[model samples]
Target: MTTTVAEELRRRELERYILEMEWEEQIRTRQAEKHFKLVEDVFRQHLGEAERMTIRQLITGAAANGRCEAMVYSFPARCCTDGGRAIEKNLPHWQKTLQGNAKELYHVFTETAKPQRYGLRAAVVDFAEGFPAEIGFFVTWEPLFFRSDESIY
Candidate 1:
């Protein structure tokens, strides 16, 4: 049996499409592996050890920008016990869902920053398929007016 020219072209096109799809899948697999490794590294360290530079940078930048809040840390939502749903929904128990370094950061914030009138906030910073993909911890403080109004001198 002899193949027509149009049939030959269609076969080549289909083969090219399949190869492209496979390449895309390979790329995605590599990216996922890298992301998982990064997440693991973050979870393995205490916040003070792994994140001091990040915190300093965030605070410095916020101050330079004249902002009262800065996102000091972020991690994949998959690290959370509830996949960041609690944080996304703003639940009071969201801190309970935090794992590893995030939990440590929260504890340190509550113990130290909170007493100093600096606030800490956790929220889902990214989403995928209507679910949280990443969570961020933001350090916050009231501006002068609100601070004075509350007599937080």
Candidate 2:
């Protein structure tokens, strides 16, 4: 009086698929170029070109810069579930959508980085000095709950 193994396997398969949400590992990888591209697109939606760029070399172009940006975002994504939105101003919903691994992605530009890090860019130097007041304000000063209010400064 032995239970048939084939029936047990089929039953188990059905039970597992029906009852379990297969856990997937969304191990985060930061693609900084895409992030910057999104920001660029977003900024373009809001502002015109503040500066113009010419690609003298195809071997080196926006993609190279994006590769650098990717490195910046990938250093450690401890803050955000995704890079599309950020979570500094109590905007936790914009946090890592997965609910645990998201991190503030601003360090990619703000930190006084060295070659050992992301290498210093002469073009980006000025952008860093004016950060908290200029660029940083946009990221750090907004509050999450009051969508219409500009309460922080």
Q: Point to the candidate with the largest lDDT.
A: 1
Off by over 4 Å in 1: 1-50, 145-153
Off by over 4 Å in 2: 1-30, 51-135, 138-153
lDDT of 2 by residue, 1-153 (tens): 787999899999998876433211110112223233444433333333542111112112333332332111222222224422333233445432322211223333233222123322111111223221111112211111223343222
Assess candidate 2 and give its lDDT. 0.29
RMSD of each: 18.1, 18.2
Please estimate how well model 1 matches the true structure, expressed as its whole-model Cα lDDT. Answer: 0.70
Residue 67 lDDT, candidate 2, scale 0-100 = 31
Model 2 vs. true fold: TM: 0.18
Which window of 10 residues has the lowest lDDT sum in candidate 1?
Answer: 144-153
Per-model TM against the reference: 0.61, 0.18
Supply candidate 2's per-residue lDDT for 101.
17
